[model samples]
Target: MEQIVGSGKFTYDVNENWAHVPPGIEMKPAAVAVDSRDRVFCFNRSNEHPVLIFDSNGDFLMSWGAGMFRYPHAIRFDAQDRVWLTDEHHQQFMQFTSDGKLLRTIGEKGHRSETGVPEDDFSSQAWRQVTHGGGPFNLPTDIVVVPNGDMYMTDGYGNARVHKFSADGRHQFSWGEPGTGPGQFNLPHGIWYDRRGRLLVADRENNRVQVFDLDGNLLTIWPTELIGPAFFYVDDEDTVYIPEHNAGMFSIVTLDGERLARWGAPIHKSIHGVWGDSRRNIYVVQPGEWGRVRRIVKYTRR
Candidate 1:
């Protein structure tokens, strides 16, 4: 029999063979997103097929995005079912149609923000200094689109700030700096905008999730001892999914910060991202380790 995991309403039966890929097709999944039809979109690190699509039953449907991304980091679907992708290597995030057509782009391609370090400073000290000097974006991470079409993104890789942008990609305001304080963040990696319009930020290095209002004001803080929380996802009922990268597990939490259930151990290759479908089935993406390729595990809620 398959192993069961989680507790109470979140209990699930693990399905290891959820996604069957063709042999020789290597996948280094950076992020995962579900569309309106419940189709799974695996954003990977392959120049040939950067986007891999699968039905909810784990059947491979199709693939696209050849020569479209330098580095695929995160994928998100907005209210209109438009796909948003963050390419850290290109230092930009873009919106696209469900069929894989590029609709818009939001940053200078390959242009990184200045870190205020000396030209001769190539040592570790210089690297630390550059990270401390918060700028527009050193390597921006995830993005959250609001109901009104506004957007918020975390400058995570080399900075610790979140910038807000208008629907058309105009900078409205920005907030944060590198620290462990309430409003501060150290590698604010993942972000999500809940139905109530509250912003949830997975402050990875700080070991906490910070909540904020639409105006970028600090509202509350949800702390976790889990190693690295790479991303955040909330179901329709407001259940939050926190994927801990290093600890090799994820906790299902309430909006009030209560951890209701936890799952994943064998799929721990490296939990980079996660999302759920309308049927409450959870999907976890492991970018794979050593020489292995990426894989997505599905857990059907019981």
Candidate 2:
């Protein structure tokens, strides 16, 4: 045995630093996503090559988005395989061809809402400053597009709300406010559509993942088992891979909010992003202080 980690059938053989960029490239890995073709994309908060692509065998395919974003926050793919990206400092949602050609952009570049937090400040506790829910983004975090072409982005960090858009990228409506009550969020960091067509919002500061209908009705909440999730990636089987930002743990849970497998050390902080490939392998990325997560890890399926 190769020192398996995780639990139950979701165990894996850990392969740390599975990929590397050329000399002088910085990958403060912010978020990660896997395409249908088995290519893994690491979206980082780096000035150079913000997007790093790799094959399932851990081969460096290519790098893109050099100087394209101030701080690349999230990455997701549509059914057509187009890349959907979000920028924190820039405060915009971006669309691109799979090869990294820009197709469109949303939101005002460098314009943030009236959240108490300033555009330049990114302290972890800044959520306390979000007095009210604002517009499209203020350090926007993650984006998810459903089958009907409706999109949802977790406008967290500087603001506490989720913005929904139509297939054409028009703002349909927005929901949530700064609070601990149901339908309210403290820091709605990550987002995804569950297998049952319900909306799942990672209410990070409140230490729970709140599920809602598309109309913004609160359904249920998944309290952190002493973990604060930063992002959520749902696999084909409806298992959720959550990277706990506060406790530095990785949790594999089900649609019913049951933890299938959870693992990590206390020293690990900001396990910011997670993605599962078709081969049952899991990809994890961390965005902490520089010189951390020197190489992103791939948890090979056991």
Candidate 3:
């Protein structure tokens, strides 16, 4: 029997084998993005094939970035269809042409910021000691380029901060610290800009989504208890799709943060990333346990 997920107008049919991998080629997709041509790109952790490209019909197209990344954390396409990737393990972010040519790189490779205290310090540590608007990145998890060419990155893992930069790769300003306050973040995992140009951050560890203006002022925060949001995909109609790892489900919400729908495999807790293309087909990356099928599943609206 064909399994279906979601409800109402958001329901979809799951295609587990949407894209086939060659024999002996293991992949654990860390992030996913679609370009203007609807070409799907999967950023995987494997050094042998760090980036995998696929056509809209799920056919494998090409692979690149081998021996060029330590950890493929996130992928996003700019307005010009250029690709931007973040390597968390290497603590660097890079830009590439659509044809896989390196354009620019940011951050000092393999170096972590001297700031940020471990979990043991808890909330007692001074905010300045943990986050001082450091340079480059400590361990960036995700990035987004605004329409004006300004860039923002969630400096994750080693540093709890969000850095803003120019299109030409100059750091402009940064904000956030390690705490539970209004401007603080635990693990600001995923980020996206809405049509109104407001920034929405998936404050993963805090189990909430924080909204802020481009200038770093906290606007609002929506509590999403039990849903550890790992990533986001805001559709053309302003619908937000969040891959919640802790809840093992996708939480569908509106631009104003209203929960509209939720669905996923209740027995599985592997959904780590999500993206949707022009046709409204949703793609999710499930990095299943050790030997399981670490694959990207396509959900077509029924």
Candidate 4:
């Protein structure tokens, strides 16, 4: 495993070597996304610059997207290399270019509604409530891009549902409800489409990951023995990494839901997100102290 720490303009790598850090940018980074060029993008709330770019070796590049985000919680890279971000407080999903150019924004701010009733039981209505006619979002936490360029967002917190959008930001379909049933979710915080294009939702408060098809069919569920399974990441090898916020650690499981390896220090009060790089280095994000003292720790196979 390797570790790196950054504060103000100073960054120290695993060997305690001084590394290049961006200037005039500081925030408790809650999420990170790496591009195909290996450039790192850090998303944090405090920095007026919501997105900070850095080279693989920690060289300071540039920063942008100021004044556009409200509690930017997670950042992800799409197949086309475009960047997608979730603003939980703003209740919206945003797309940006690699250079931080705002491409599109979906969802309305401060709009709230009750959806997924028997009348709107079809998956399509859930998508409309989030994308078309501008229905209110309770809190949108995470986003993922499908293999075909569509997008899937977890509408958690206030509302329990998942909304899908086409590549052009059109509402495609949506599913989920605020129950503990097979297709229900309690704080569906993080979502991702696996290699097979199957959707996996981290039913956070429920402590399980519910698998569903593109059409909202409940396929399977992976129950976690721990509480608060907040986020999930499926690797190219079909292994799943799940981070439990309550436990302050992450577990690696097979696609079939068998526990493999687990690692972390109990010192982490809350683990929020997880991501893996090309080299299979696992990165965990912990947002702490009102975003004042966040940390990203990298782990590797022992």
Candidate 5:
């Protein structure tokens, strides 16, 4: 019998071999995104062809982005179907055409902000030293572009802030600090500008989602009972999908943060990325930090 997951109207059967990886090719997917055509793009950490493209039905279409990234983190599409990618290790974010042509690159490569954290300090307690917010990024995790072409990024790992930018790549302003307060953040891992005109930030380490206005004003909070809410993918109907890392699970929530359904696997943990197609089929990917590494899963709607 095939493994089935999810609940309520969000259930699906796992398609383990959804992507036909060519011979001698591997997909160490860090995150996933879909274009207007619902073409699946798997932004991975591999050295060769880190950007893997696939058809809606799991056929391998093409690949690109050879030797262009280190520690690929998040991949998202904007209103124009352009690609936005974040790389925490490189301490930068980049923009690309859907075909993998580099348009612009942000952040000074190899430069980390002075967030009171040491080099190579991955300790849990290290974030406590972030006395205040910083500029553009210091190991930024995820990004989002609003309808008006404004951008927001969760500068999580090495900093505790959400940096906003203009459509032309100019720094606008930033918000957040290191603490457990309403507008504060522990690790602002993921950011998404929902259709409701609210910025949903996955404040991962704090175990909550912080909703804010476009101008960085705190609106509300959703203690959606998630662990390590790494990233988000909001569907057309304003339904929210998130991959919770520590819980090894993903959740389906309404626009108001009400849980519709949630599911996880015993063999999976640290699910960092999640997206879906028009067919309602779900796609998820994983990295090696928690348990499993280099895995991309597809769950077809039933």
Candidate 6:
């Protein structure tokens, strides 16, 4: 596979491919997280089973989590190397060992029976009908960990807020509401805690990034002109890489929202997710008409 770097428009590398399609499984790859060993874990929304795993070379290693997961949207690795996943459809969060052992599960599932159900009503019929809950999470899109081991999750989409949890998956506190206010969110999709402990959230529909303190206090907003800035990552040098799902490309920006590099052509529409490995190789999830494909492209500093 050929590698491309620097800031010129490029076509999707049809040669450099890394994907794992296990038997009886469909690949609706939504998120990718690489462990310390360079092993890639891809989470899909196609089935309620164990997420898919692939080696650095994209070879199928193993699979786990059968009979578990409702609508797994995001996969993340903590400092301790533990694996965490958020199920937006069922309003639940789960923790697992790097090898896929179920460590713990958070939030409740089931249907709502009445109107005006409280946001935390885990079993209300209304809860089942809507995506955001005033409680645990109506549809958690992403998760991140602070330096202190506390976790921050974007309880976005159906619900417009972010929830904080202890390392043990215990709910600590949450912030944000359904509005355009500074503290409120429209669709808080992805989240990350920068090296400075400043919370960075991908306010997708709002076309901006919302900064906050560890306590959920609104700090400021950075406008990103890209349509649907769904997910992003902040590198060691504070370079922010945001994948624009609607635009079919990714932008490398600074903390102040300056575009550094842009890649991908219009043919690669729906670039839903992005991740970089220790080798500075950027992996993107491109879901197109046929199916979802994972492309691993290497980049270098200019």
Over 4 Å off, model 5: 122-129, 287-291
Candidate 5: C-alpha lDDT: 0.84
**Which window of ten consecutive residues has the lowest lDDT sum in model 1?**
119-128
Candidate 2, after superposition: displacement of residue 143 in Å? 0.8
Q: In model 4, which regions exceed 4 Å deviation?
A: 1-24, 114-136, 223-226, 287-292, 300-302
Worst 10 residues of 4 by lDDT: 10-19
TM-scores vs. true structure, each candidate: 0.91, 0.94, 0.91, 0.81, 0.94, 0.83
Question: lDDT for every model?
Answer: 0.80, 0.83, 0.80, 0.70, 0.84, 0.70
lDDT of 2 by residue, 120-165 (tens): 6776677788888888878888888889988888998899999999
User: For model 5, what is the error of residue 302's alpha carbon versus the real structure, in angstroms, after optimal superposition?
Assistant: 1.2
lDDT of 5 by residue, 43-68 (tens): 98788978999998888888998888
lDDT of 4 by residue, 12-78 (tens): 2332121244556675666876777767777877648788776655567888888887677888888
Per-residue alpha-carbon lDDT of candidate 6 for residues 81-154, written as tens digits (9 for 90 to 100): 88888787776778899878888777776432122335454431222233333655665678887877788888
**lDDT, candidate 1, 1-302, per-residue tens:** 67798989989997766886767666778899999999999998999889999999888888888898987889989989999999876878899998999999888887767655444442323334544645565677899988888889987776678889998889888888777888988778899998777998988777788889989899988744656678988998999988887667888888867788886664474578888999999888764333345577788999
Clash count, one per candidate: 1, 0, 0, 2, 0, 10
Model 3: per-residue Cα lDDT over 1-302, one tens digit each: 69798899999998878887776666788888898888899998888888999987888888998899987888988878899899987878899997799998888888776565443332312332455445556667899889988889997566678889897888999998787788888777888988998999987777788999999899988754537788889998999999887667778998888888887764447577788988899889874433344588898988
Better of 1 and 5 by TM-score: 5
User: In model 2, which runs have C-alpha deviations exceeding 4 angstroms?
Assistant: 223-226, 287-294
Estimate the TM-score for candidate 2: 0.94
